[model samples]
Target: MTLGTHGEAGLERGRVDLQRYGHALMGTYGEPMRVLARGEGSWVWDADGNRYLDLLGGIAVNALGHAHPAWVAAIAHQAATLAQASNFFATEPQIRLAERLLELAHAPHGSRVFLCNSGTEANEAAFKMARKTGKRTVIALEGGFHGRSMGALSMTHKDAIRAPFAPLLDTVVFVPRDDEAALRAAATEHAADLAAIIVEPIQGESGVRPLAQGFLAAARELTRRYDALLIMDEVQTGVARTGAWFAHQLYGIQPDVMTLAKGLGGGFPVGAVLAFGERVGSLLAKGDHGTTFGGNALAAAAANATLDVIEAEHLLDHAKAVGEHLRAGLEALDGVVEVRGAGLMLGVGLAAPVSAQVAQAAVAAGFIVNPPSPDTIRLVPALTLTTAEADLFIAWMAEHGTRITTEGTTA
Candidate 1:
């Protein structure tokens, strides 16, 4: 169907679409802010025909931005050739994608990849791998977000979300992020039963807070000492989102296991669990785990194309440069206190608890961003976001920053 047509017709279409959406869908997400119709590089148009700079990049899923030509072509070609073949048989794209991931990750010999369809599924697989260790305890960080599924939610630290799902796995322990002492203490206490210590290199949901280098080193050391796995949840920070191919690479630490999604598929739905070394690779035996559509030809082709485009377009360097540009701009804004994170994954800290207001104002002014916390605005825009696009948001913030924050306070 034609979407984003201009004028009152578009407005009417949007309204009708929203009404239908409300009636047909679950309210788990409350309400979608807009009926986005179509998208291109760094921008999207709603059903109402309003254009917006998509700085959120579908929450960092669109690594190549919306509708990248190469990514689209790969998917199209693969779909025509072969899309799905159950786990009973594997395809060339699937095998090649796994090899590519191992090479990009610099995984050691005997390393393996388990492909899946989303971040939660990848985390779930990791959880099972941890369980396969014959140990019961896992140490996770406070304010960390793994995913919404039962297995992932158990390891997640959010109380509100977990409260409803009472009786989550009790063996998991929570430690404060970057608190090396607490982490060491927990590791020592749970040494015998410790299966793994899962962490996000940068806590995306908790305001893009990166784990201290020393703390990550400590986790690595402790996990080794206790013979437990170190799982880095790079779902939000992998695939060149953080300038580096993976955030852990920046710290010079390698995880025994790494979970990836988001940008891996570059807008297509795909996830992966990389098990380092032969020992970790054999954690899940045949019949231990399976998926119907994971790493299907189409998904693998999309991901391969994404990695290809990222390299060909030199997006790693571009992300770093544009990210620095955006960070400086955000930090220079009137109400912005600081900017945290690397590459396109940024959190704009505000002087007041008005990030929600700022995000609202941003969208109204034709930019799209999100407030992960009351005082932090998250910007996980596409790797393709240009300095020109970033400057537009920056300029708008410069003009309206103080007013939006003030209005939020008065309201």
Candidate 2:
């Protein structure tokens, strides 16, 4: 596993050369660990001949896990059948996915979907649909990460992330997440000038923070009273990740528009904006907005397969059981202050800012956890993660907690 050498047969020789070639080729991501050679189920192998159980699950993208037979077959079949068709022509997968989305939405009637390429694109499309209401203002929750695109960035809460992209789309106000008063005042005051109120049922990138039950309902009611659209960005919490078709369903709230991505296509790129009823659905007309790669045959086929697997496998119930076990174990950690979120989208809050060190230890221990903040460690594992895998992560957390505490004390 030397940094500059190649490996033997079937061993991912690219691991060593990847760092060198990657430095000269790609941007921003830097050198990835072990040059991930292959993956199956909930495990991945790096170039150095190391295998690890994937607790992070590609940031919650690989719902059915790596190299699921169904997904592989679907993609290969679709590739052989039809990979891409210009938006001018209709495709079966696209139509099927659209129908499935509406059924998942369970909207009254006449709900429509606008397909796209990523979570950012989904949010951008939602922003476009919100704008079409002839209003320009939006109220977003603090500590929420929507996407990096202009419109999505505008709704993002972190100052550091937003300051770099200064002079972003204006009229987007951010209020503390789970703070009902601030949301109520802002939405009511600027009701007429507001286009929509965007909120994530469980804030993903800022750490897995779920909005308070009453708080989300208030947003819905406020949007209704102010005649503003309510947008639920489920990019990180949809598609059985939270043991539901969508996270908002847990709170019994219905959003006017719902944006989805992340796990939607398992691993393939796919995004969508679901608008309920005529008032919101008709906002975008022909030629109003579109993406060249949006709803392409390949992405649609992948998404359809992903949905079918979720349904046939009953992964939602599995997620609920495993998530509960994971959360209980995490909450039992000594220095752990609290455990938040539901289903597989769980976050652990530490007594101090040791999450980075804890995450490093977890990496060494073969688990991948995201430290979204100094004190918040988020875990969004694949939906198909087995009970054994869940228990292993719990054990890892207990050991890592002790390691982190000892290191902190010694420091």
Best by TM-score: 1
Q: Give per-residue CA lDDT, model 2, range 1-411, as digits (tens).
A: 111122354344654567577768766655565567688998887766566778788888999999999999999999999999989999999999999999987976878999999999999999988889999999998888889988899988888878988999878998888889999888878977988999999988887888999999999898888888999999999999999999999999999999999899999999999999987989999999999999999999999999999999999999999999888887888888888888989888988888888776666656767888888888887899988887887776676554575457412
RMSD (CA, Å), each prediction: 2.7, 3.3
Clash number for model 1? Answer: 0
- Model 1, which residues run further than 4 Å from truth? 1-10, 406-411
Residue 169 of model 2: what lDDT?
84
Clashing pairs in 1: none
Separate clash counts for every candidate: 0, 0
Worst 10 residues of 1 by lDDT: 1-10
